[model samples]
Target: MSNTSRDAVLARIRQGLAAGPAPLPPRPDFAAPVHPPLNNPDIVVAFAESFQRVGGEFYYCESLEQLAVQLAAFQERQQVGPPYVWESDLQAVLQAAGIEFLADEADFIANADLSLTSCEALVARTGSVLVSAATESGRRLSIYPDQHLVLARPSQVVAEIGDALRVMQERYGAQQLPSMVSLTTGPSRTADIEKTLVLGAHGPRRIALFLLEEEENNG
Candidate 1:
């Protein structure tokens, strides 16, 4: 409270600092993984389990036809208007399947209900999808819609989050990294309201991932 007492406190603090900085706390092994391996062997299975546990819909498509059928059913069941798709790759698949989509930049969000987008990679360990602003899907198309439908191949699935980051770097490292690189684990949810859980409070109410098998692409 007194100036003298304050000066003494400051002097003591300076003396302690002069003695040398306090030893740092024991540091963790930076090289080691923060999380243990899932050890599930089947990365795809690991992904499905973690994803569904958090209210994500996991669909395994043996063939493109099956993917189309399931996607159409999801569209019809939810009664969401035509999905918004931007990427040419996804557009080709949709066209082949005869699934109509809204890709016009001006009208894409006019009546958006379902958003079908491609992802960078799938993190099997965390059930997360790595998305970026660099792609045609951009950002809002995946988050603003009532339902988000990700179209990915099994080959894109990786063992951990680090692997997903690696993929992001490898793809866009030459160019500046995308303005946004997001790892979305599941549908948006919040329990901040009196501890009562609510889904889709901020984003999509439903999140579905369809992993098309590699062989299907050969055919």
Candidate 2:
């Protein structure tokens, strides 16, 4: 074998070793409202607004398509920017929403690219979005970029952390799970130095939640 062939084989072996722990089953999509109702919209609004209160900006949209629009616009406003990768599922929705997809990759790379994605339920109790590494859509789009935007319907929001975990176990079996599952609550925050809560400490400085309402339950 050539030197390049030996190098390729070695790289693949190292990659496998670093994959870490048993894999969780694929991220499962549960059939529940993406955004559950709160006794007061104030509670939900407050949860969303808390990000801004701490210096991070939050934008809530009615649908994924609206999110795509706002996401693209946000990139345009930034002095320094995160790469924009739109989820392909979102692309179809964007087109229908009247936003055109640019032909040039440069255009997207220039102003917010998008990655098509699907996510498990968002937990209502803590406003944390559950993501499993086992799913491609679940991984890169949320973490790689400097800013993260999650589009979930009210139907996918579950009530608590345990509920989200239960759903994961059901799909992947107990033995097979990702090395790490991230439960992100708002943006990264810390109050270490002077005990002043600071936002965007470890992750994106912005987060937007779109509570898409369904007709069946206005109750």
Cα lDDT of model 2 by residue, 53-89, tens digit: 4443556566546665676686578643443434565
How do the residues 24-87 of candidate 1 rate in per-residue lDDT, one tens digit apiece?
A: 9998899997888785888988888888876789888887789878887887888776788989
| Stretches > 4 Å off in candidate 1 | 1-33, 215-218
User: Which portions of model 2 show Cα errors greater than 4 Å?
Assistant: 1-83, 98-118, 213-219
Assess candidate 1 and give its TM-score to the true structure: 0.80
| Least well predicted 10-residue stretch by lDDT in candidate 1 | 104-113
Candidate 1 C-alpha error for residue 3, in Å: 45
Local distance difference test scores for all models: 0.85, 0.59
RMSD (Cα, Å) for all candidates, in order, is 6.9, 19.6
Number of the top lDDT candidate: 1
